[model samples]
Target: MKNILIVGGSKGIGNAILLQQLEQNKVYNISRNAPEVTHDNLVHFSLNVLEDALPEIESIDTIIYCPGSINLKPINSLSIDDFRNDFEINVIGAVKVIQKYLATLKKGTNPSIVLFSTVAAKLGMPFHASIATAKAGVEGLVKSLGAELASAVRINAIAPTITDTTLAAGILRNDRMKENMVERHPMKGYLQATEVAGMADFLISDKAKSISGQVFEMDYGIVSFKI
Candidate 1:
């Protein structure tokens, strides 16, 4: 079985990914809160991605960085600190964690790294300036690092649009709001946390050994086509 490290695996897509891989993999979850789901193979590290030190572990076959922010505000309303906070959490935090564990990842079997982005990074959503800018940096990190570490490790990213998660509770709280989001996607359905988790599973598996430096947009057609 592989040893999988999931940053921010306590909730949302990260939690789902932790659960998905528990049956056959040794999973390490690093986040501020403890994970809701318990498994024999799961190890939870209670720490903030931005501040705390990661547990000393080696031979990580895969890492899925799932921590993100969804601060939707118009560009004019966004403060300088807002942009900085988003970049710190979404980009800097991931980079720091990965840098710390890169050696361990190199020693693992077909090691792969997965990071998250947003459809807004490419689609130019009106009120997504902060997060889009941050995730766009994440996308760039995936490509540059994917190439830099190509011989030993594979790095990639997933860009999803308006996923149904606690982080997005404000957007999907009401029927009207939910309907508006669904209608924006050609598929007429938004992404679920578990579905995104499944995609993460695929990316790190042997099936995706040849795939790296790419951002897979799981936007339900919101950023790709018109309904």
Candidate 2:
């Protein structure tokens, strides 16, 4: 079994990916908090990607950074710190972790790294100023790194719209809110955590060996047609 290291693998899409990963490999989970789930194949490691460098990541075959923030406030309401915080966890934090584990990733068999972004980066929704700016940076990072890390490592990202995760509970708290969100897409619903995670698992698997530098969209038509 391959050794996979997933940062922030304790919840939501991260946790869903972890569950799928556990079915096939030894998974090292790096996160600030413990996952609500338990597993015998899991090795949990307390790691705040923004706080410290990864430990002995040289042994990890793949590393997926799930660090991100959803700051849905308007541009005027958002402070400079809001954008700063978004970029820190969304882009900078992921970079720091990847750099720390560069050697290990290079050591693995066709090492792959996955990062998360949001559909707002490309869709340009209101109240997404702070996060859209930050996730935009993440997109740039993924493209640049994918070019630089080629042959030895593959890099990709997924950008989804308003996934049904705790991070956006406020947006889906009631029927009115949920209905408004669902209507935004032709599919008329937000992505389930399991659904997005399944997409992620497919990317990391050997089946996607030739895939790299692509930003996969799982937005349920939010990024395109609504008809």
Candidate 3:
């Protein structure tokens, strides 16, 4: 069975991907807090991606970095630590995972690495300067690593906008905010957590062998046809 490690898989999109893949692979979810999933193939560990490099790594088949923080603020109001923290979690976190699992990945038949970014990293949006800027760094990190890890491991990222995760509580909590977000997309709805899991599965599967060093926007057409 393929062995996969997911950093920050206790909640949001990460948990969905971990659960979806459990049917076929041995899944290890690294999180500081306990997750609410149980299965023979699923192993949950208390891990801090920011303070740790990855744990219990074996011949890793695929690894996904899911630690991200959203700090939305205007340029003038943004603090130095805000930018630093964003990079620490979103950019540095991915690097730590790759470095820790690089050797193990090389031992796999065809290893894959996935990171999460934001649609704001590609498309422009207001009040997204801080998180957007950090996720933009994430976009660059994946591409560069993809090239360096080729043949053995493939690196890719998923950038989504306005998904229905707890991370989007502020935006989806109120009627005005919800309606405003829906109106921006032609589909008039947000991308679901499962939709992203499907994308992640594709990226790590044989069908995506030719895909790497790119950010896939599963944004409900947020980048296309700005109506």
- Tell me, by lDDT, which candidate is best: 1
> Over the full model, what C-alpha lDDT does candidate 2 score relative to the true structure?
0.86
Give the least accurate 10-residue stretch of model 3, judged by summed lDDT.
50-59
Q: What is the lDDT of residue 178 in candidate 1?
A: 97
Any idea what lDDT model 1 has? Answer: 0.91
For model 3, how does the per-residue alpha-carbon lDDT over 92-156 read when each residue is reduced to its tens digit?
A: 88887778778888888678999999989888888788899899999998888878876667899
By summed lDDT, which 10 consecutive residues of candidate 1 come out lowest?
A: 50-59
Clash pairs, candidate 1, are none
Q: TM-score for every candidate vs. truth?
A: 0.98, 0.96, 0.95
Please tell me which model should have the higher TM-score, number 1 or number 3: 1
Between candidates 1 and 2, the TM-score winner: 1
Per-residue C-alpha lDDT of model 1 across residues 124-221, encoded as one tens digit per residue:
77888899999999999999998899898999999988889899999999999999988888999998988998889899989999999999999888
The candidate scoring highest on TM-score is 1
State the displacement of the C-alpha of residue 173, model 3, in Å, after optimal TM-score superposition: 0.6
Score candidate 2 by TM-score against the native: 0.96
Error of 1 at 132 (Å): 0.7
The list of candidate 3 runs beyond 4 A from truth reads none
